[model samples]
Target: MTGRRIVSIWFPRFAMDRWRKAHADTDDGLPVALASEAAHGTVIDAVSEAARKAGAKAGQKVTDARAIYPDLVVEASDPGGDANALMRLCKWARRWSPWTALDGADGLLLDSQGTAHLFGGEAAMLADMNNRLRRLGFASRIAIAPTIGGAWALAHFGDRSGIIIDDDALDGALAPLPIESLRINADTALLLRRLGLKTIGDLIDIPALSLARRFRKTPDATTNPLRRLEQARGRIEEVAEPLVPQTVYRAAQRVAEPVLHVQILAPILADLADDLCKALEDGGRGLRRVRFEAFRVDGHIAALHAETAAPVRTPDHICRLFAERLETLDAGFGFDAFALTAIWHDAMPARQKGLAEDEAEGLALPHLIDRLSVRIGVGKVRRAVAYASHIPERSVVWRPALEEQPGVAAMQAPRRERPIRLFDRPEPITVIYGTPEGPPKRFRWRRKLHDVIKVEGPERIAPEWWRERSSVRLRDYYKIEDEDGRRFWIYRNGLIDDGRGGPPDWFLHGLFA
Candidate 1:
């Protein structure tokens, strides 16, 4: 328990607590029960302490409970609401430890190793946790131990609150506890109890070979009691998923009071931007994308994101990018914490700012692109970037302006003259040539016959060998001018006697102004 300190918290009356919180008008002495619809009909899901004392218990038929105590108060239970509430509590628990998670439906797990000293040692930390939850109207049973399973068992089944189990006392502490405390399923517990394995100590006394033979070793420990026991005794490592992501670059501030508006949040966001920018500059890195989040007092997080057209190191620029979008935050019950993370970055691009007006104007465009993207959407504002393909129609692609156009696009091989307007898909045309494989003398396109005044070429372009099979056809492109001086970009798919098919098909690919 001293090495990897784990904290397990159980909320025995979570559903009833939620119901009470919502219906504050209810008298505390009233016998309240939360009911749910089952195949057998309406059944009690959870009960208040007053109801339990009044002879009403969970899993009882609502009609029977009503007959037993006709004055009992019953409301439908919301399983989804209870689960969401638990997850919210898990995320909020990160205020004490970053490694926190929802443990089942009514518990929370926290990897509180090395954090106890911050809150004035282990006992004080537990005391603080109990006080905080009491203020939020939740009753909690907490325990800290060396392993996750041990902590969980002690918290749920231990004789006292705030139980801290040391490594040497782990066996003694767990031995007397019921086997169900190991988190095995009902069926497994029943099977073990039938075999005279009533307590954790009983399982420990069984031969290891017999235990393995009786229980199937499955990944889910709930079905395999032996595996659950191993995890509890620290024979297996327990991995708990963290509630918050540990981003590479981040800045956060916890406030004394909840902030209600972006006007109040702007300055805080600016400071975070400045700090993040300084760190990025030191590492010779730049912010390509950032996540700005507001943590609400009610446990909901309102998040916004900003992406740049290129690597940016300017704090003011980053702040400006998130300015307009910040107004959209749903600050329910207001936000008590704010965080910014440079989730995506790249090596800063080297640029020499010359005194020339054109160079300054060139830098302005990227800034403009970034702002436009945040205001509208990243996908709305787009630009063209070259693609690595010899096929004329596939040579370029449209992308979001916020994404940097790869340098390879600018350094690609020079291409031949292309038309100003390209067709989305080629249009089939009929060509009349003097020879079977010769240049077209005339062509009929859009139901109009155009006499070829000048035919430029049979520019041979082979299929992309790497992308297509060898059987794929090649193209013979041509620039032709009609008698009326209209220019068209056309190509013949395949070749005569190519052995793959019949005669080649001619099509119009583009148009020239």
Candidate 2:
């Protein structure tokens, strides 16, 4: 079978390169080395070509290297910065292939099966990539093979740096490489070396069963070697996990001149919104969250993000939301490019409009909520949702208005007389004329006296025995109205003398409009 083509790009001095670029302004034409802390002392992690010529090498102790060459420049290694720089390069590589991914901290893998033709075939693509990296101040060794594993091994171990198109020549090409190219453990490699099997060709003729039995003592001794062998020979599949794009729907444009005024950005954003909405419509999807980014000429990026209450695909609506956020974008030194992306989306198949006019009106509330949410903030608008608890306060939850509501099966049983407003914590009240087990007749709350003129009977609600122990108090709630027509939901905690605690306390829990 014809396997997929893979390209591996390895940056041998990735960390050192990034460090040098960060200090480019202060860099003198001297040898430099990056040191990482080891158990014994700081060890050289990477060395510049000049440093290597000056008798400095990786793995050498820093103090010894300094003694050898006192003028050698040393800086602490930054592994994280290297990884981030590699990822940024991966993103920039999307111009060549969408399936580019980081192989390790120092390398990248690009599945270029059908993409090489776009850049004038495999050889041209390799040259193009090498030239681009050179322009970016990165030195890369690139190799192309029919398999990911083969490409990776060739990039790091083989003498060749260009395309390896003849699959039949793989064994011959890989035979002369050291046994360490198979990615086996140091112990296994040492054992193989001792046996005079110092190359992949030395073991290929041996029976698989014999190899397994001979190396049974080593962890994954048989499987690891055999798997790498098969992978290198293209006998087994090598799957590439590509990086996930930040957005599903994205449109970006680079302008001939940088834009400084917010008014110029408005038109550009509107056009991007139109393009994004069209793409969403084609995909039968709608956006819930959208982001607009302005990449400034000075390397600063300004972004504006907005959320919608419902799935939306109209350019007009999207543009209006972005207009509200345009003021927040700082066009530092002017923006060179504009990008609009749909960060979050949902399926929104087209539907026929309702026959009744009220049906259309029903949608207005959600649309209004979306607009308001964009203007203020999503957290500022909330909607009540039924929760799965029997306790009054626990029975309902308040969530962001734009969030998808829970399904019916996930909600608690319908409540018969839930109050319009519930207090975060029940307020303590002083009851003057109420029986121990009955609703209060007169109460003083918040420095005001209330004479109960109308009263509803105790709706006894037991505590959730499954979740909490029986020692928890039960509540007998009463709906009472004051002489001034103010309504309150008061509950008596614990039975009058149930032995759970002191005499039950009267608390005002909720208010009804």
In model 1, which regions exceed 4 Å deviation? 217-219, 245-513
- Which segments of model 2 are wrong by more than 4 Å? 1-248, 298-300, 352-363, 402-411, 446-455, 465-471, 481-487
Residue lDDT tens for model 2, 194-247? 989898888675544346456556556233676667667776555656886433
What is the Cα-based lDDT of residue 233 in candidate 2?
72
Clash count in backbone of candidate 2: 0
What is the C-alpha lDDT profile of model 1 across 76-180, one tens digit per residue? 899999999998898889888889987888999998887889999889999999999989989999999999999999999999989987888898999999999
Model 1 residue 139 CA deviation (Å) reads 0.7
Worst 10-residue lDDT window, candidate 2: 405-414
C-alpha TM-score for every candidate: 0.48, 0.47
